[model samples]
Target: MILDKEVQRKLKIEPIEGSYNSYAVQEREKKDWRGNIYLACVAAILAISFFT
Candidate 1:
């Protein structure tokens, strides 16, 4: 699974050959942790505006 591939990468383990490109370094670069943190902050702001 792609999750395993990503986890392995984060843990510095080598993934098996012939896996899909979902976790390729180039593609994952755009969707890194910083991007996720930004998205989370945006979502929190939207939720706050909606509720209060």
Candidate 2:
């Protein structure tokens, strides 16, 4: 499920018809600032574990 942005851009890739638009994705995360903070905490833990 890896959408390689570099390859896609170079190849002029386009999404399928009737797909969920980018706006929908933005709206879904619009009110999820708290979730983002939690993710940042988890990422910090993982980074610390890796570096330490």
Candidate 3:
């Protein structure tokens, strides 16, 4: 498959290794409490909708 020039350019460019690692670590350390609550609400809604 052929890639676009822009995509090729982006793929060839490398981010700073240390900064990339730290950014990934920071992202992993962050929590999404609202997302968890939203998922729980959706699960509860589905359970009630189907089980009742």
TM-score, one value per model = 0.40, 0.39, 0.41
Estimate, for each residue in 3-47, the C-alpha lDDT of model 3 and write its tens digit.
655432212333557564432222223365998999999999999
Task: Please give, for residues 1-52, the per-residue lDDT of candidate 2 as tens digits.
Answer: 6676543222334555687752222212236588899999999999999999
Candidate 1 at 35: error in angstroms? 0.6
Report how far off residue 5 is in candidate 2 (Å).
Answer: 44
* lDDT (Cα atoms) of all candidates against the true structure: 0.64, 0.63, 0.62
Tens digits of lDDT, candidate 1, 1-52: 4665544233334455688643423222335598889999999999999999
* Residue 29 in model 1: lDDT: 31
Q: What is the model-wide C-alpha lDDT for candidate 2?
A: 0.63
Order of models, best lDDT first: 1, 2, 3
Task: Give lDDT: candidate 2, residue 30.
Answer: 30
Clashes of 2: 0
